[model samples]
Target: MKKTSLGIFTVASLAIACQSGNQAGYDASGLDSTALASITEEAYKSYVMKLSSDEFLGRKPFTKGDTLTVNYIQEQFKQLGLSPGNGDSYFQEVPLVEIDTKPVSPTLTFTGANGSLTVKHLDDFVVSSKRLQNDIKINQSELVFVGFGIVAPEFNWNDYANIDVKGKTVVAMVSDPGRYDKSLFKADTMTYYGRWDYKYEEAARQGAAGILLIHETGAASYGWNVVRTGWAGPQLAMVSDDKGASKTEFEGWISQETATKLLNLAGLPKDIQEQAKKTGFKPVPMPVTTTFALKNEFRESKTNNVIAKIEGSKRPDEVIIYTAHWDHLGIGEPVNGDSIYNGAIDNASGVAALFELAKAFKAAKVKPERTIVFIALTSEEEGLLGSEYYTQHPIYPLKKTVANLNIDAFSPLGATKDVSVVGFGQTEIEDYVIKSAAKFNRTVKGERNPTTGGFYRSDHFNFVKNGVPGLFMGSGSDFMEQDSTVINKRKAALGGRYHTVRDEVTEDWSFDGILADIKLFFDIGYTMSMEKSFPNFKPASEFKELGDKRLAK
Candidate 1:
């Protein structure tokens, strides 16, 4: 009943077409081109609209929304006849601890030679404890400005080189030194050292009691609202043996205005922050101490990762994975009279594409030679938790996983002439992407903004960390009906709506772009699934050694 370029062909008609020396028709393996073309815009839009509806409550983890989302995806998988990806189960339990902390009245107090200064919460600063404890406090913790708080030997940079930050609170800059000097580290592109996650990890390693990063828009690539939303409600993290005690007692951010006022109070020039950008800049011990305490409320909970598989007909043990996070910011601080962060484009779109891809593979007359596993992950907004857990406790052997193809936050601007491959040159999977896109007269291009550190920001990074080659692609800007200016405007508009209530499904949404992108993924996965060769990380990749090690094992 479906129309395609190759025309509507049933099984019998496809067989007849194949008999006429038509290589594009049904193959001996029973794969019909018509079925591949059956992936339609209507099917894709239906899934997105349903998943991003208000009834789902934004799909945040450990909420009613989470329950509704997991159940829906599981039912879809069951209906599609996909076997449980986990051992006899479609769900993989991820143990998590949720911490809800509220600052005591008079949240932050700083005392030094200039006198005492009091800062309010939410407006000037926000703080919380990751440690699982009834009471947490930093009493007169000596405050020190530790530049970017980076200590990368590769770049010959260390902000805490001569100073001992033990038992002190380090007020650090948001990004790395390279942000100022392009020659420092990876030029303008942000390395692992530039991420807030890396900042917290480094601070913990230095035995700091607390760390507050000065929020800056350009460097952080987001506004304060994102930070506030992340700090609000119940914060989820994988339960650790130490209950996160090894990390700082409290980690947070202060507005640039607040940081300036605090610096002035510490008898340091407001403009002294620029000094920290230089390589030889030493940690400046602010002539002040900060005091704060948090009364904590904690709950231990679990979330499920929905995984389904279509086993290979030939190499059953080998796998090609497709992943997308289903979780988004749930009911939080309201914006424009809307509390739900629908995340329609942020992730609901990606999940819908996952379902469509699964449907396509299932509908194919011939099964892939290597297994295909589709995973709808949870808590990606929190920090790639589901994928990290799965990697640690893998359902299939890591060495046998030929490649990971991740879809996240797709564009709705219709089909384009190119696709953006995040971390394009890091692995050999780019070859497959290029080949697949070329089939439709589309080209493969690298991410337009590598400085955002986008390669490390998504779920695929987890797979790459475990030595499996992973590819994450998004729709490009060269729309068929629109020029670069219109495409750029659409992308800019989407950027403004990211992580906000305005991210809900809109009337003008188009699925032509998504349909093309999904078909590209199908082609890439199919090629990987049937090939005898395994893709490896390129020589320049930091993950190359890990991939080689895993393969060797």
Candidate 2:
């Protein structure tokens, strides 16, 4: 069961909140609203415009865009008087390789007692592999529907037990089939097993030649266009050790319609779906050869994590990290005439937020007790590559790294009375946020879609996995004393143009929402810096054991 941490500052009650006349209260007493009037809407608008401009080149990884973005971040850190985090250097080099593998024209040679059939790519199947080898192929192999294709002993679900897929391809349901028929599994909430990342990883572990997910828009929460566009672009993989992959050779997704046809060719009843949902279901192979011809060019390049440190007043070695990914999908296939994925909201907002906080601290009358490290990580969208590398090889050890605060895709919804923490119950940092949000009469809420794994999907997961307490929250739509129509106007902008060429800065967006969220983030950082105690995961959190293990030192 999920556990909520004790409300923050409750334990530190007397130590945290200040009296109306106390100097420690963040707000200045007797200060008029006119004092902050100088911090105008124009200032925030101007900042967003520069960060999301087309010259940033969709802020893509391993490109000229990265050159401009990293340089700007480093320069801003310098202006803030933050020293280079990596001994005399701000950059922590992250090597990566871009492998643009074109989906081969699939020759689905289906032979049966009825006749012989051939299927084409897109119309029939799409194949991809991380192998990067030129001769990536899978011919004369069989296709199988493997009941979500998951094997989790904990869930008492193993769709592929007692079966050997040594050299064959497995066609599986995309997401978790349990999503559609909840009674069959977790009931609408997708588990880790349902993710395509997990399904393909299992295929490789099973020694399969290929794996393809059947794409249904509603189930996947993405359209076929997303699959097509993502595959059509240059895909990236991190530079890793020579230890080879137990790679699935021809791996990709097929349309649900095509999957239905393939099942029909195998003389299989479509009702196999319900049977697969039940326990004790096993994978069965259909005699078929899904053929494809994949070709691609590979390029290896290096990227850097821009790191700068604001030294603490006393315990300077211990650090608090504030991070945002400076990389995006980069330049890719265009929708309409626009070719750039400027990444305006996806992260230009995050990068902008980090820099703004750095500036705020620089202007503060007092400094923090622990070092504040501003890290604009590289290749976050590319498998959390940069942050992963940093976690493995830190400028400062994980034990001394106090906490990590990550920002991504700040919605431009007008200010609200609540702030939604992406992974709310994961740590004790929730307490700190709850205490601070109360100042503005804003309540803290949990993620709207835990099934999507947004927390794991972002860079902070790397830190959390390595035992650093982390927090990520955003301004929400619900308002305490605001109009209902006002909330809809903001939510209307949610799905429109996300991750598209359409994601751009405009006058229509009110930065008030972003401004409010950023202010809260600054307060969180300030509170963590001043408090004598270190925040850890609450006992109720799954991650609390990690905090216990570390803090026991």
lDDT of 2 by residue, 1-553 (tens): 2223334443343344444215532453211122223334565566567768888888777889989988988887787678999999999988777876775554556565455567666555555657656656556677777878898886688878888888877878766656656565555545657777788889989988788788877767777766765665676677656412556765788787777777777777778766776777888777655555678667788889999988889888788899988887777776788888877888888888776777666655566777888899998876788999999899998888888999988887677778888766678788778776765567778876655556667888788877788887898657543676766765676556666787888655768878788777876786687666778886755567788777777
Cα lDDT of model 1 by residue, 1-553, tens digit: 1123113223333443345324545544333566577787887888898999999999999899999999999998998789999989999999888888888774578898979878778877887778999898778899999988999987898988888888999999887777788878877667778888889889999999999999988888888887777775678888999988898999889988888888999988666889888778888999899877888898899998999999999999999999999999999888778899999998999999888888888877667899999999999998899999999999999989999899999888768888899876799898777655655567677888777788889999999999999998988867786567766666666657778898877765767888889888887897678778999999978789998998898
What's model 1's TM-score? 0.92
Cα TM-score per model: 0.92, 0.89
Q: Highest lDDT: give the candidate number.
A: 1
The best candidate in terms of TM-score:
1
Which residues of candidate 1, in runs, are more than 4 Å off? Answer: 1-32, 269-271, 483-495
Q: Could you tell me the lDDT of residue 381 within candidate 1?
A: 94
Evaluate model 1: give its lDDT: 0.84
